[model samples]
Target: MPTFNQAYWEERYKNDQAQWDTGTVTPPIKEYIDQLSDKTKRILVPGAGNGHEFEYLVTQDFKNAVMLDIAKEPLANVAKRLPELDAARLIHADFFEHNATYDLIIEQTFFCALSPELRDAYMTKAHSLLAPGGKIAGLLFDFPLTEQGPPFGGSREEYIALFGNLFKITMLHRAYNSIKPRAERELFFIFEKK
Candidate 1:
């Protein structure tokens, strides 16, 4: 199993080879963010490469948003675009080692980028990072699992099985508003920490 480690991901960024980067936040996530009334919610976007969603939160007036990644290039790119956002809010660290809590964690391609062995750890960490009643909302890919991918895939059943122990599955279904390429192949979900 190819562990999606910092070095591996960093090299991909260095080569500008992030095929997963949509260059903009996906439509489904935008819609989800649109419903959020509280701008003070402490939101965390881990593995936030290039930070499209991170910038979106800030532009939407989410004052407590944080963007964290293990690579420097994407973080630097984000800094260049959103110069006014606080440097403290942009973190360059491993998600597993990050020591803070959030009211919400926005997932994009982050979860699917990891090896299967780390899925449970990712669930555990997400549960730990979220405060009581906090939630995680975002897209997860829906396809077969294979060895050759950073953008790996899994089914809704597998995800429900993996996360139901810790989260209340508020929403898990096909994403109707994804970008053209991702439309039918993704699932939009909101899992509230119990």
Candidate 2:
């Protein structure tokens, strides 16, 4: 496997090789956001490449939306795309190093992009980032875990085993609204901090 680090992602963005980026927010996530009644919730989207979700949140009148990425390129792209958003909200730092807490964290392609070895760390970091009663909600790939991807795949059983101890598994099931390419191959989940 390649490093899957800052440099690797930066290079991917520079070369326009970010195949994981869907030019718009995924349908499941959009539907999830559409039901949110609290527009004031402190929300964070880590590894938010291109920040389509961030843009959507802003459009929906969410006040405390934050977008974080390890690489500068994507964050810069977000800044360019949404120049009116506060610059401070576009964070360029390692996700584990980020210190603030949030009421809701949005996870899309972020988790699967990490090396499988970092799974535990990702869970731990996410747990620490949430305020009391906070939740991490989004899609996780539902395919096999293999040695061949930044878009690494995982199963529902594996997710339950990994996240069950630290979070309340509010929902974990096959996503009914995943985009065509990911149809039936992703799990829509809502894991609330315990």
Q: By summed lDDT, which 10 consecutive residues of candidate 2 come out lowest?
A: 77-86
Which residue pairs in candidate 1 have backbone atoms (N, alpha carbon, C) closer than 3 angstroms, thus clashing? none
lDDT of each: 0.93, 0.94
**lDDT (Cα, 0-100) at 88 in candidate 1:** 95
* Highest lDDT model number: 2
Compute each candidate's TM-score over C-alphas: 0.98, 0.98
Model 2 stretches with alpha carbons more than 4 Å out: none
**lDDT per residue as tens, model 1, 60-101:** 999999999998889999999988778999898999999898
Encode model 2's per-residue lDDT on 1-194: one tens digit a residue. Answer: 68888999999999999998999999999999999999999999999988999889988999999999999999999888887888999999999899998999999999999999999999999999999999999999999999889899999999999999999999999999889999989999999999
Q: What C-alpha lDDT, on a 0 to 100 scale, does residue 62 get in candidate 1?
A: 96
- How does candidate 2 score on lDDT? 0.94
- Each prediction's number of clashing residue pairs: 0, 0
